[model samples]
Target: MTARLNPDLLHRPGLAAYRLSRALALSRIGSWHSYAVIATPRAGMPAMPKGYSYRIAAHMGEFEAVAGVAGVDLAVAQRRLDDGCVCLIASRGAAPVGVTWISLKPVREDEIAALYDCGGRAAWDLGLHIAPEHRASRAFAALWAATGDWLDMHGLAWSLSRIALYNAASLRAHARLDAQLVGRVQALQIGRLQWLRATIGGQTTLHLSGIARPPKLALAAAIMV
Candidate 1:
Protein backbone atom coordinates (compact mmCIF):
# COMPACT_ATOMS: atom_id res chain seq x y z
CA MET A 1 0.00 0.00 0.00
CA THR A 2 1.24 3.45 -0.83
CA ALA A 3 1.46 5.57 2.28
CA ARG A 4 0.38 9.21 2.18
CA LEU A 5 2.33 11.77 4.15
CA ASN A 6 0.84 14.28 6.53
CA PRO A 7 1.91 17.60 5.01
CA ASP A 8 2.01 19.37 8.33
CA LEU A 9 4.40 16.83 9.75
CA LEU A 10 6.94 17.69 7.08
CA HIS A 11 7.13 21.23 8.53
CA ARG A 12 6.42 20.33 12.13
CA PRO A 13 9.17 22.51 13.52
CA GLY A 14 7.67 25.69 12.14
CA LEU A 15 3.98 24.84 12.36
CA ALA A 16 3.25 24.37 16.03
CA ALA A 17 2.52 28.04 16.59
CA TYR A 18 0.76 28.39 13.25
CA ARG A 19 -1.61 25.54 14.01
CA LEU A 20 -2.16 26.82 17.56
CA SER A 21 -3.08 30.23 16.22
CA ARG A 22 -5.60 28.67 13.85
CA ALA A 23 -7.12 26.71 16.68
CA LEU A 24 -7.35 29.81 18.86
CA ALA A 25 -9.04 31.73 16.07
CA LEU A 26 -11.56 28.94 15.49
CA SER A 27 -12.31 28.77 19.18
CA ARG A 28 -13.03 32.50 19.18
CA ILE A 29 -11.41 33.28 22.46
CA GLY A 30 -7.96 34.78 21.87
CA SER A 31 -5.95 36.77 19.38
CA TRP A 32 -4.77 34.95 16.24
CA HIS A 33 -1.15 35.21 15.21
CA SER A 34 0.60 34.50 11.93
CA TYR A 35 3.00 36.22 9.56
CA ALA A 36 2.29 37.52 6.09
CA VAL A 37 5.14 37.52 3.59
CA ILE A 38 5.73 40.06 0.87
CA ALA A 39 7.59 38.46 -2.02
CA THR A 40 8.99 40.32 -5.00
CA PRO A 41 9.33 38.00 -7.96
CA ARG A 42 12.36 39.11 -9.89
CA ALA A 43 12.45 39.75 -13.60
CA GLY A 44 11.70 36.66 -15.76
CA MET A 45 9.19 33.86 -15.95
CA PRO A 46 9.03 30.16 -15.44
CA ALA A 47 9.53 27.76 -18.32
CA MET A 48 6.34 26.93 -20.21
CA PRO A 49 5.42 23.31 -19.81
CA LYS A 50 3.14 21.18 -21.94
CA GLY A 51 0.06 19.08 -21.06
CA TYR A 52 -2.08 22.06 -20.06
CA SER A 53 -3.92 24.75 -21.99
CA TYR A 54 -4.05 28.30 -20.61
CA ARG A 55 -6.63 31.09 -20.59
CA ILE A 56 -6.04 34.69 -19.58
CA ALA A 57 -9.11 36.44 -18.18
CA ALA A 58 -9.09 40.18 -18.75
CA HIS A 59 -12.87 40.75 -18.69
CA MET A 60 -16.13 39.47 -17.22
CA GLY A 61 -17.31 36.53 -19.30
CA GLU A 62 -13.80 35.26 -19.83
CA PHE A 63 -13.37 34.69 -16.09
CA GLU A 64 -16.43 32.46 -15.83
CA ALA A 65 -14.56 29.56 -17.36
CA VAL A 66 -12.49 29.23 -14.23
CA ALA A 67 -14.38 31.03 -11.49
CA GLY A 68 -15.66 27.93 -9.75
CA VAL A 69 -12.24 26.31 -9.91
CA ALA A 70 -10.69 29.47 -8.53
CA GLY A 71 -13.06 29.49 -5.53
CA VAL A 72 -14.83 32.80 -6.21
CA ASP A 73 -18.22 33.24 -7.81
CA LEU A 74 -18.88 35.12 -11.02
CA ALA A 75 -19.77 38.36 -9.23
CA VAL A 76 -16.47 38.46 -7.38
CA ALA A 77 -14.59 37.40 -10.47
CA GLN A 78 -16.30 40.06 -12.54
CA ARG A 79 -15.42 42.70 -9.98
CA ARG A 80 -11.78 41.74 -10.23
CA LEU A 81 -11.97 41.78 -14.02
CA ASP A 82 -13.23 45.37 -13.98
CA ASP A 83 -10.33 46.39 -11.77
CA GLY A 84 -7.56 45.89 -14.40
CA CYS A 85 -6.50 42.65 -12.76
CA VAL A 86 -5.93 39.60 -14.94
CA CYS A 87 -6.45 35.97 -14.11
CA LEU A 88 -4.62 33.20 -15.94
CA ILE A 89 -6.30 29.83 -15.73
CA ALA A 90 -4.95 26.45 -16.75
CA SER A 91 -6.81 23.38 -17.85
CA ARG A 92 -5.95 19.80 -18.66
CA GLY A 93 -8.32 18.74 -21.39
CA ALA A 94 -11.56 20.32 -20.11
CA ALA A 95 -10.70 20.15 -16.42
CA PRO A 96 -9.61 23.38 -14.77
CA VAL A 97 -6.34 22.71 -13.04
CA GLY A 98 -4.81 25.95 -11.77
CA VAL A 99 -5.06 29.73 -11.67
CA THR A 100 -2.83 32.80 -11.37
CA TRP A 101 -4.09 36.34 -10.75
CA ILE A 102 -2.26 39.65 -11.03
CA SER A 103 -2.94 43.36 -11.10
CA LEU A 104 -1.27 46.54 -12.33
CA LYS A 105 -3.67 48.96 -10.69
CA PRO A 106 -2.36 51.45 -8.14
CA VAL A 107 -5.68 51.59 -6.33
CA ARG A 108 -6.97 49.08 -3.79
CA GLU A 109 -9.87 46.73 -4.53
CA ASP A 110 -12.49 45.53 -2.06
CA GLU A 111 -11.70 41.90 -2.85
CA ILE A 112 -7.97 42.19 -2.23
CA ALA A 113 -7.94 44.73 0.61
CA ALA A 114 -5.20 47.34 1.23
CA LEU A 115 -2.63 45.35 3.14
CA TYR A 116 -1.79 43.75 -0.20
CA ASP A 117 -0.97 46.89 -2.12
CA CYS A 118 2.71 46.68 -3.06
CA GLY A 119 2.75 49.93 -5.05
CA GLY A 120 2.83 51.05 -8.70
CA ARG A 121 6.01 49.48 -9.95
CA ALA A 122 5.18 45.86 -9.20
CA ALA A 123 2.15 44.03 -10.58
CA TRP A 124 0.18 42.58 -7.70
CA ASP A 125 0.37 38.79 -7.78
CA LEU A 126 -3.03 38.46 -6.19
CA GLY A 127 -3.19 34.69 -6.06
CA LEU A 128 -1.98 31.35 -7.41
CA HIS A 129 -3.88 28.14 -6.89
CA ILE A 130 -3.44 24.62 -8.23
CA ALA A 131 -5.94 21.91 -7.41
CA PRO A 132 -4.50 19.33 -5.03
CA GLU A 133 -4.66 16.66 -7.70
CA HIS A 134 -2.41 18.70 -9.93
CA ARG A 135 -0.12 20.18 -7.29
CA ALA A 136 2.65 17.71 -8.12
CA SER A 137 2.45 18.36 -11.83
CA ARG A 138 3.69 21.13 -14.13
CA ALA A 139 0.44 23.02 -13.46
CA PHE A 140 2.27 25.54 -11.30
CA ALA A 141 5.12 26.03 -13.73
CA ALA A 142 2.72 26.33 -16.64
CA LEU A 143 0.51 28.82 -14.85
CA TRP A 144 3.50 30.92 -13.82
CA ALA A 145 5.04 30.73 -17.26
CA ALA A 146 1.86 32.03 -18.85
CA THR A 147 1.50 34.71 -16.18
CA GLY A 148 5.11 35.80 -16.61
CA ASP A 149 4.74 36.02 -20.35
CA TRP A 150 1.69 38.23 -19.99
CA LEU A 151 3.37 40.49 -17.45
CA ASP A 152 6.44 40.81 -19.66
CA MET A 153 4.40 41.76 -22.69
CA HIS A 154 2.37 44.24 -20.66
CA GLY A 155 5.47 46.32 -19.73
CA LEU A 156 5.25 45.30 -16.09
CA ALA A 157 8.75 44.92 -14.62
CA TRP A 158 7.94 42.51 -11.78
CA SER A 159 5.29 40.97 -9.57
CA LEU A 160 4.69 41.34 -5.84
CA SER A 161 2.70 38.83 -3.83
CA ARG A 162 1.74 38.11 -0.24
CA ILE A 163 2.13 34.62 1.18
CA ALA A 164 1.30 33.06 4.49
CA LEU A 165 4.53 32.50 6.43
CA TYR A 166 3.40 29.17 7.80
CA ASN A 167 3.52 27.72 4.30
CA ALA A 168 7.16 26.73 4.60
CA ALA A 169 7.23 24.76 1.36
CA SER A 170 5.82 27.67 -0.58
CA LEU A 171 8.31 30.06 1.02
CA ARG A 172 11.13 27.74 0.04
CA ALA A 173 9.81 27.47 -3.49
CA HIS A 174 9.66 31.24 -3.81
CA ALA A 175 13.26 31.47 -2.63
CA ARG A 176 14.33 29.06 -5.34
CA LEU A 177 12.79 31.38 -7.90
CA ASP A 178 15.00 34.21 -6.62
CA ALA A 179 11.98 36.07 -5.31
CA GLN A 180 13.09 38.71 -2.79
CA LEU A 181 11.58 39.33 0.61
CA VAL A 182 10.08 42.80 0.52
CA GLY A 183 8.51 42.88 3.99
CA ARG A 184 6.52 41.22 6.78
CA VAL A 185 3.13 41.78 8.37
CA GLN A 186 1.86 40.98 11.84
CA ALA A 187 -1.78 41.37 12.82
CA LEU A 188 -3.79 40.65 15.95
CA GLN A 189 -7.53 40.64 16.56
CA ILE A 190 -8.91 40.99 20.05
CA GLY A 191 -12.61 41.35 20.82
CA ARG A 192 -13.68 44.50 19.00
CA LEU A 193 -10.18 45.85 18.67
CA GLN A 194 -7.94 44.75 15.84
CA TRP A 195 -4.42 45.89 15.08
CA LEU A 196 -1.88 45.39 12.34
CA ARG A 197 1.66 46.56 11.77
CA ALA A 198 3.39 46.16 8.45
CA THR A 199 6.79 47.06 7.12
CA ILE A 200 6.87 46.99 3.34
CA GLY A 201 9.11 48.71 0.82
CA GLY A 202 11.04 50.24 3.74
CA GLN A 203 7.97 51.99 5.18
CA THR A 204 6.29 50.94 8.40
CA THR A 205 2.62 51.56 9.08
CA LEU A 206 0.05 50.67 11.72
CA HIS A 207 -3.73 50.31 11.56
CA LEU A 208 -6.58 49.85 14.00
CA SER A 209 -9.72 48.18 12.68
CA GLY A 210 -13.14 49.77 13.09
CA ILE A 211 -16.34 50.14 11.11
CA ALA A 212 -15.84 53.89 10.88
CA ARG A 213 -12.13 53.72 10.05
CA PRO A 214 -10.20 51.82 7.43
CA PRO A 215 -6.63 50.63 7.38
CA LYS A 216 -4.11 53.46 7.23
CA LEU A 217 -3.13 52.12 3.84
CA ALA A 218 -6.75 52.05 2.74
CA LEU A 219 -8.66 55.08 4.01
CA ALA A 220 -11.98 53.65 2.86
CA ALA A 221 -13.53 50.50 1.45
CA ALA A 222 -12.42 50.52 -2.17
CA ILE A 223 -15.35 51.02 -4.49
CA MET A 224 -14.21 50.18 -8.03
CA VAL A 225 -17.53 49.62 -9.68
Candidate 2:
Protein backbone atom coordinates (compact mmCIF):
# COMPACT_ATOMS: atom_id res chain seq x y z
CA MET A 1 0.00 0.00 0.00
CA THR A 2 1.10 3.53 -0.70
CA ALA A 3 1.88 5.22 2.56
CA ARG A 4 -0.54 7.99 3.34
CA LEU A 5 1.15 10.96 5.01
CA ASN A 6 0.15 11.42 8.64
CA PRO A 7 -2.43 14.17 8.73
CA ASP A 8 -1.64 15.07 12.31
CA LEU A 9 1.93 15.84 11.34
CA LEU A 10 0.89 17.93 8.34
CA HIS A 11 -1.70 19.90 10.27
CA ARG A 12 0.65 20.87 13.08
CA PRO A 13 2.66 23.88 11.96
CA GLY A 14 5.75 22.93 13.90
CA LEU A 15 5.74 19.38 12.63
CA ALA A 16 4.87 20.47 9.11
CA ALA A 17 7.77 22.87 9.04
CA TYR A 18 10.09 20.23 10.40
CA ARG A 19 9.04 17.73 7.76
CA LEU A 20 9.22 20.29 4.98
CA SER A 21 12.72 21.25 5.99
CA ARG A 22 13.79 17.63 6.11
CA ALA A 23 12.30 16.89 2.70
CA LEU A 24 13.84 19.94 1.14
CA ALA A 25 17.19 19.17 2.68
CA LEU A 26 17.06 15.52 1.71
CA SER A 27 16.44 16.43 -1.89
CA ARG A 28 19.68 18.33 -1.80
CA ILE A 29 21.83 16.17 0.49
CA GLY A 30 20.35 12.72 -0.29
CA SER A 31 21.39 10.67 2.77
CA TRP A 32 21.44 10.39 6.55
CA HIS A 33 24.07 8.95 8.83
CA SER A 34 23.51 5.88 10.97
CA TYR A 35 25.40 6.07 14.22
CA ALA A 36 26.32 3.33 16.68
CA VAL A 37 28.04 3.32 20.03
CA ILE A 38 29.37 0.45 22.08
CA ALA A 39 27.50 0.13 25.35
CA THR A 40 30.50 0.08 27.66
CA PRO A 41 30.17 2.29 30.71
CA ARG A 42 31.28 5.84 30.01
CA ALA A 43 32.51 8.33 32.55
CA GLY A 44 30.38 11.36 33.38
CA MET A 45 27.07 10.09 32.11
CA PRO A 46 25.15 13.22 32.98
CA ALA A 47 22.80 13.03 35.91
CA MET A 48 19.14 13.93 35.53
CA PRO A 49 19.07 17.71 35.88
CA LYS A 50 18.23 19.34 39.22
CA GLY A 51 14.48 18.73 39.29
CA TYR A 52 14.03 15.89 36.83
CA SER A 53 13.83 12.13 37.31
CA TYR A 54 13.86 9.33 34.77
CA ARG A 55 11.60 6.28 34.64
CA ILE A 56 10.70 3.61 32.15
CA ALA A 57 7.05 3.53 31.22
CA ALA A 58 5.60 0.30 32.52
CA HIS A 59 2.16 0.46 30.91
CA MET A 60 0.09 1.99 28.14
CA GLY A 61 -1.20 4.73 30.43
CA GLU A 62 2.29 5.88 31.24
CA PHE A 63 3.17 5.71 27.58
CA GLU A 64 0.09 7.78 26.75
CA ALA A 65 1.06 10.38 29.28
CA VAL A 66 4.52 10.69 27.80
CA ALA A 67 3.08 10.83 24.30
CA GLY A 68 0.73 13.60 25.30
CA VAL A 69 3.60 15.60 26.72
CA ALA A 70 5.68 15.01 23.62
CA GLY A 71 2.82 15.88 21.25
CA VAL A 72 2.87 12.51 19.53
CA ASP A 73 0.04 10.15 18.63
CA LEU A 74 -1.16 7.97 21.52
CA ALA A 75 -1.93 5.07 19.19
CA VAL A 76 1.54 5.11 17.69
CA ALA A 77 3.09 5.27 21.14
CA GLN A 78 0.90 2.40 22.31
CA ARG A 79 1.87 0.25 19.36
CA ARG A 80 5.54 0.72 20.13
CA LEU A 81 4.94 0.04 23.81
CA ASP A 82 3.05 -3.17 23.02
CA ASP A 83 5.85 -4.22 20.72
CA GLY A 84 8.17 -4.30 23.74
CA CYS A 85 9.79 -0.97 23.01
CA VAL A 86 10.79 0.91 26.16
CA CYS A 87 9.93 4.56 26.65
CA LEU A 88 12.18 6.44 29.05
CA ILE A 89 10.37 9.42 30.45
CA ALA A 90 11.98 12.40 32.16
CA SER A 91 9.68 14.26 34.45
CA ARG A 92 9.74 17.13 36.89
CA GLY A 93 7.50 16.26 39.78
CA ALA A 94 4.37 15.08 37.95
CA ALA A 95 4.88 16.52 34.48
CA PRO A 96 6.83 14.63 31.83
CA VAL A 97 9.10 16.88 29.78
CA GLY A 98 11.24 14.49 27.76
CA VAL A 99 11.21 10.98 26.32
CA THR A 100 13.45 8.55 24.45
CA TRP A 101 12.54 5.17 23.03
CA ILE A 102 14.75 2.12 22.78
CA SER A 103 13.94 -1.06 20.93
CA LEU A 104 15.68 -4.31 21.84
CA LYS A 105 14.53 -5.94 18.65
CA PRO A 106 15.59 -4.93 15.17
CA VAL A 107 14.03 -1.73 13.78
CA ARG A 108 13.73 -1.43 10.01
CA GLU A 109 13.28 1.78 8.09
CA ASP A 110 11.96 1.18 4.60
CA GLU A 111 14.43 -1.34 3.13
CA ILE A 112 17.15 -0.60 5.65
CA ALA A 113 17.35 -2.30 9.04
CA ALA A 114 19.30 -0.78 11.92
CA LEU A 115 22.14 -2.90 13.21
CA TYR A 116 20.43 -5.74 11.43
CA ASP A 117 21.27 -9.39 12.10
CA CYS A 118 23.14 -8.58 15.25
CA GLY A 119 22.07 -11.70 17.14
CA GLY A 120 20.18 -9.76 19.82
CA ARG A 121 23.12 -7.64 20.88
CA ALA A 122 21.90 -4.28 19.63
CA ALA A 123 19.23 -1.71 20.46
CA TRP A 124 17.82 1.05 18.23
CA ASP A 125 17.25 4.47 19.78
CA LEU A 126 14.66 6.83 18.35
CA GLY A 127 11.88 9.31 19.10
CA LEU A 128 13.84 11.52 21.46
CA HIS A 129 12.13 14.72 22.54
CA ILE A 130 12.50 17.43 25.13
CA ALA A 131 10.02 20.17 25.91
CA PRO A 132 10.66 23.55 24.25
CA GLU A 133 11.21 25.18 27.61
CA HIS A 134 13.88 22.60 28.44
CA ARG A 135 15.82 22.58 25.14
CA ALA A 136 19.17 23.90 26.40
CA SER A 137 18.98 22.47 29.89
CA ARG A 138 20.88 19.20 29.32
CA ALA A 139 17.65 17.23 29.63
CA PHE A 140 18.25 15.45 26.34
CA ALA A 141 21.78 14.53 27.24
CA ALA A 142 20.58 13.27 30.59
CA LEU A 143 18.00 11.10 28.88
CA TRP A 144 20.62 9.79 26.47
CA ALA A 145 22.92 8.91 29.31
CA ALA A 146 20.04 7.13 30.98
CA THR A 147 19.43 5.18 27.80
CA GLY A 148 23.04 4.05 27.73
CA ASP A 149 22.77 2.94 31.35
CA TRP A 150 19.63 1.00 30.56
CA LEU A 151 21.36 -0.63 27.57
CA ASP A 152 24.33 -1.59 29.69
CA MET A 153 22.09 -3.09 32.34
CA HIS A 154 20.29 -5.14 29.71
CA GLY A 155 23.66 -6.47 28.45
CA LEU A 156 23.20 -5.00 25.00
CA ALA A 157 26.54 -4.10 23.51
CA TRP A 158 25.48 -1.63 20.86
CA SER A 159 23.27 1.46 20.79
CA LEU A 160 22.24 2.63 17.35
CA SER A 161 20.46 5.73 16.03
CA ARG A 162 20.00 7.70 12.82
CA ILE A 163 20.54 11.40 12.25
CA ALA A 164 19.15 13.14 9.24
CA LEU A 165 21.68 15.12 7.24
CA TYR A 166 19.98 18.41 7.98
CA ASN A 167 19.64 17.84 11.72
CA ALA A 168 22.76 19.58 12.93
CA ALA A 169 21.62 19.73 16.54
CA SER A 170 20.97 16.00 16.78
CA LEU A 171 24.23 15.24 14.99
CA ARG A 172 26.17 17.28 17.52
CA ALA A 173 24.33 15.63 20.41
CA HIS A 174 25.13 12.12 19.17
CA ALA A 175 28.70 13.16 18.51
CA ARG A 176 28.97 14.21 22.15
CA LEU A 177 28.08 10.63 23.08
CA ASP A 178 30.81 9.38 20.72
CA ALA A 179 28.53 7.47 18.38
CA GLN A 180 30.41 6.27 15.29
CA LEU A 181 28.89 6.69 11.89
CA VAL A 182 28.54 3.14 10.63
CA GLY A 183 26.14 3.56 7.78
CA ARG A 184 24.33 5.97 5.49
CA VAL A 185 20.95 5.65 3.79
CA GLN A 186 19.18 7.66 1.11
CA ALA A 187 15.58 7.34 -0.01
CA LEU A 188 13.79 9.02 -2.86
CA GLN A 189 10.17 9.07 -3.90
CA ILE A 190 8.49 10.41 -7.01
CA GLY A 191 4.80 9.84 -7.62
CA ARG A 192 4.37 6.05 -7.23
CA LEU A 193 8.04 5.31 -7.61
CA GLN A 194 10.43 4.92 -4.69
CA TRP A 195 14.12 4.10 -4.41
CA LEU A 196 16.50 3.42 -1.54
CA ARG A 197 20.24 3.04 -1.15
CA ALA A 198 22.38 2.23 1.85
CA THR A 199 26.08 2.23 2.58
CA ILE A 200 27.84 0.70 5.57
CA GLY A 201 31.35 1.49 6.63
CA GLY A 202 31.82 3.44 3.40
CA GLN A 203 30.76 0.48 1.24
CA THR A 204 27.48 0.17 -0.62
CA THR A 205 25.37 -2.59 0.87
CA LEU A 206 21.70 -2.11 0.03
CA HIS A 207 20.56 -0.68 -3.30
CA LEU A 208 16.92 -0.90 -4.17
CA SER A 209 16.25 0.11 -7.73
CA GLY A 210 12.60 0.95 -7.09
CA ILE A 211 9.38 -0.07 -5.39
CA ALA A 212 5.87 0.44 -6.67
CA ARG A 213 3.16 0.92 -4.04
CA PRO A 214 5.53 0.78 -1.13
CA PRO A 215 4.24 -0.40 2.23
CA LYS A 216 2.65 2.56 3.99
CA LEU A 217 3.10 1.48 7.58
CA ALA A 218 6.84 1.00 7.28
CA LEU A 219 7.32 4.21 5.33
CA ALA A 220 5.19 6.19 7.77
CA ALA A 221 7.02 4.74 10.74
CA ALA A 222 10.32 5.71 9.13
CA ILE A 223 9.11 9.25 8.49
CA MET A 224 7.78 9.59 12.02
CA VAL A 225 11.15 8.67 13.40
The models' CA-based lDDT, in order, is: 0.62, 0.55
lDDT of 2 by residue, 52-154 (tens): 7789985787676567566557776776676567888887767777898887665444223232332354566677888898776767766866786787688
Per-residue lDDT tens digits for candidate 1, residues 66-149, read 666686667767767776788889887778888878876643434222445534555777668788888888887787787777
Best by lDDT: 1
Candidate 1: lDDT of 190?
64
Tell me, by TM-score, which candidate is best. Answer: 1
Cα lDDT for residue 53, model 1?
77
Stretch of 10 with least lDDT, candidate 1: 216-225
